[model samples]
Target: MSSKRVVFDFDIAFTNGGGIQGQDFRLDIDGDTITDKELADYIVNDMQLLMVRKVDIINKHYITEAHKRKPVNLKADEKLVDLSHTIFDGLVTYKGLPAPIICDYLSREQSKVNYEEGTEFQIGKITMVTNTGTYIDCPFHRFEHGKDLSEVALEQFADLDAVTINAKDAIEIGKEYFVGKELRNKAVLVFTNWAKHWNTELYFENHPYLTGEAAQYLKECQVKLVGIDSHNIDDTRGKSRPVHTTLLGAEILITEHLCNLDKLPENGYKFNAVPPKFKGAGTFPVRAYASLG
Candidate 1:
């Protein structure tokens, strides 16, 4: 009998639009030790789950180190690529509401003076809610008993082993969809095809969502994190948020309003969606991104 072996792929592809779809993993065991026929029988008989393990190794490796070394260089005279955008303005506010106001200014103060003879200075403050744009809802957003945004450990938000589930057209995501899958101790990202309605009213109604049973199953499995590229993780029309309640109640962080998830591989790139460490705050906008290293 030959020894058993497993093959892991790190360069998984995350699509460019919204839905999450990519290679999560492909397990390979020695044919002599386990026998191809025996392995197939085990899967048919529901015993293969015991033979695979998906480990989180983000802390032990640099996520963007590969990109840093081999930067994306354009022509020396080429125009730069504009990567930043303000998606949330007066047009579309949180919960389809109004935006915040800005006030206060220090016009006369100056720190250093490359002072022109007729110079003026101004300082100001802006008052906006945390859910101004694409944001993350930590466990504290739902439960007072859970850890607040500041109290959440950094490891929970950054350098996470990410898995993207393709649920774009799925009306309901249930436990059956994830049963027997290695979901424990990893970031479980859901890519619903709802982002297509980003600026339209359709994005707010009848959107796809994870079932309450699925949330409970994830919590029981101890998923490290949960994210969805949708307006809200819960059904907007429903009063009870069983999905959010179950996952957050178990102290799992939730990230909402993610874009470019389609660009991520199902199980390869390192996911990092970090919010500010603000005390007493449960939710905040984040520069959520993935590192394909």
Candidate 2:
């Protein structure tokens, strides 16, 4: 492959009031030479500088050092597996909650008079509660003053190294299942295969759930998030919700009603279940999925 070389001077400023001024440098890069902004980012990352805010290129076309590094091949064998149930109109997810109302706010036939010939539009509207489908629960779901959906960071919900625990036929999952696994900063998904009953009457009754002891163990291990392919993370028949209380109190996000866990390996995938940034809302549906790499 051919290489492109660039010589430039830069001034970099850090976040902590520290700055580097007028540093001349040269770089040999693969493919075409990068833009000034790209060059600045390369410099900051290559130098391993911290808290950098700005990098200004000062001089152009001055040779200094000949450094050669192969360009990274970003292409990888990756696959995305959908782990969410499709939310349909008049389809019930939970027993008591109302089904989503899907209707067209602006019908295509109605828009014919307002538009030119053969031009029409349809605007759709959906009305449903936050807990309608595959949904995420933030700390505010259990606590009145805890972090809401908007307050949770993106890293807590997206691109996390993940592991799946096969707990099929197990109703009360405990900490023993997670004993030997690394749990820190990982999305720990419990697969019970209860999602097979989705859209059926059996999905809401006697479903698999995590024990409070398991939730405490995950909290102690600092797991970033937890998910389950079941009806609810906690046993809904009981009045007390210990699992939700323990997990959410620790600010560990929870995703319920996740499917397709069989598609993911134990540890080779990344998990993402991001919800909308709605203030004052604790729970909302997410398009949960996994990336196998």
Full-model lDDT for every candidate: 0.66, 0.88
Worst 10 residues of 2 by lDDT: 69-78
| Model number with the top TM-score | 2
Cα misplacement distance, residue 276 of candidate 1 (Å):
1.2
Q: Residues 3-102, candidate 1, lDDT per residue (tens digit)?
A: 3243222221223422222233234332313333333343334433332322221111112111212222223223222111254335453464667565
lDDT assessment of candidate 2: 0.88
lDDT of 1: 0.66
| lDDT of model 1 at position 103 | 51
lDDT of 2 at 145: 95
Candidate 1 residue-pair clash tally: 12
